[model samples]
Target: MEHMDSSMDIQHLLMMGMDLYRWTFHDNWSEVVEQYKNNAAIHTMPINNKEDTALHVAANNNNAVAVKQLVDEIKRTTSAVESLKKKNGKGDTALHCAASIGSLQMCMCIIEADPHQGHVLIEERNKDGETPLFLAAAKGHKKVFFYLKDCCVGESIGLCRRTSDGQTVLHCTLYRDHFELAFEIIHKYKEGIVGFVDEKGISPLHILADKPSAFESSSNFRWYNWLAYQCIYVKPLRITSHSKSQQTALRGSTADTENPASNYISEHENVVPKNYWTSYDIFMAFTRFIIWPVWEAFGLEVIKTSRKKKEKHVWCGQILDGLWKHKDVAYVGGRVKAYVMPKPGRETDGPKGDAKQSADGGSQKVTADQDKLQGDAKQSAGVGNQKVTAD
Candidate 1:
């Protein structure tokens, strides 16, 4: 319970076990026994200026070997779970330190050492309401983030969680230009997260829309931009293809590398929609999702008398309205549908080889049958047109 200053005495005490802390960072485990035997009390004693235990110091240093030994040595006397859970001055356990440092090995060492309570430890939040996975994301540590993600398999989907500031790991990725990681969050978390507006009232789409410059710097900008726009702008539509061949064509040419989607839009059969989506849907999405927030915050303003008048342009909505009113968008013939991209969310919803092959095959068969029914309806319409011409 005592506070240890950063002074030499504390440094010297930390030197004992914390030397093992440093040594483990270099991955040297030799003579660890003699070191622990010589000054067991001192090393186990409160060490850092913040009074971080030896384990905390080791984790802060990203020393997996030291963390493992300390956990092992301590497991004999006290519970490894409790020791790993101990917090320092900043309310961070060794796991928190490891996560912030983005060291997967160090984190795994601590977690594996205390398997009984590791899940609790991994999910534990610091003062910031950020779990270890969140810290890894904040640090741009994808490998560490991935390992921790696997641990949250069935139950804690909150692994893709937000911080106290209402920033998810997806936001953290974009802030650091980890483009792929941003998509990973969208694909992994799906609808449960995609609709969530953070404390700032900004959805993930808002994040991408704000950072257009990010597209310029991304190495896989084509893929990244396409994916971002899909999650941010298109996913909400829930659009579907009209025919089997259309779906197959889209599945093959999703990327520009093979065949651009624009080619299909201009040349191929119009991708028919499954449901009716009206102008209001577009208006609501633009106003509520995009335009209103900006309009409310920084849109056109005029000063009248003693007060300033803020006029809502509802600009995003206005743009959609203008486009529809202009007759530039043609609804003639079969309605064209955009090709669906296979992203993380799509992984479980993809091909015969993936996600429950038999079930997916059945769904495909159902789709084929629906396509046939539509084809028969079109033939009947053709016959009706011919009879009217004869009359």
Candidate 2:
């Protein structure tokens, strides 16, 4: 001690502090922490490459005990809790890092350190504009999602949101086939769905209606299907009105070059039969193609019975007849007016049981068998210990 140079001694203590910070993040909190407690130079050491204190490293690594120790030291020495908003090299605070990792407890601790930090919790975007909520949602951390929901009370839930394709969180949720989380968000924020289009002009329903095969492949296909069905059925409310001049000028104008009126009646009248089917029609086409083919292949009798029963209903038959009479006026004319033809002795159970049983039982068995085969193949391939990866 008598011979040690002042600068060398200071450097030695700083180096020891850096090592302690590293060990704390490595989850060896007890050993090097005492050195941190005794050395004044420890608090000044930087481990985040941005000259941040040990607290920054502890928070980044989600080491709660280390954070507490650092906080206590700061309080005892400086007589005040240090600001939790200290930014690292990438402009991320401890809360941001905890959020990126979906560490709910760590996020709570940072917020508890300063309640005002809750706003910053989701508001903080990484270098890529991804908020903590976005990360949690994309990574499928249900707990983190709930935690953010809780913290967002009295604050805007729309904070720090970014879509994978640069849309809002609501828009991103719409494109997601798994609707459990998205439904929760929409229920809380009802107006969130309006005008939330993705890169395409396609709304949430349009997105959900697309790629029926994608839903079929998901583990939660039934839920996705139900949600997609809901999306398809719930037509958005129309609010705008066209000018009287615009409406009258287009009345009865069957000319191919005339602008179609915005009203549903005029639009339907003007649409060329071949072009009448929108994206919804196309989606339904693929959906039926994938789902109906399987049903027809295995349950031809059930399909026949369902079709016959549906046709036998007098109301349905009459509607078809009326549509056929007005074929020239309706878009898609003859093709759209075709009735469900009845087959002799092929009528049963409102066609309900047949469709339900086939869709439910057959699909369940097929999925179970496929899952079993995949598990066996994976085991044989020796990747059985690996985590199942999602697309």
Strongest candidate by lDDT: 1
lDDT string for model 1 (1-391, tens) is: 2444447666676467566546544645555544554554543455546867767767776656666667767665566676677777777778889888876556666776655667778777777677887887777765566666665545344554555665667657656655434444544454334333344444344444444232212122234333332233221212122232332343222232112232222111245443334454577678676765674566322111101100111121221222223121111112211111122223333221232221112222111232442333233222111221110
Which residues of candidate 2, in runs, are more than 4 Å off?
Answer: 1-17, 31-45, 48-82, 116-118, 153-155, 163-165, 171-178, 198-207, 214-391
Q: Write one digit per residue (lDDT tens) for candidate 2, span 96-120.
A: 6666566655555555554554555
- TM-scores of the candidates are 0.47, 0.44
**lDDT scores of the candidates, listed in order:** 0.48, 0.44
Quote the positional error of residue 52 for candidate 1 in Å.
1.4
What are the per-model C-alpha RMSD values against the true structure? Answer: 19.9, 24.5
Residue 120 error, candidate 1, Å: 1.1
Let me know the TM-score candidate 2 reaches against the reference structure.
0.44
Model 2 has a clash total of: 0
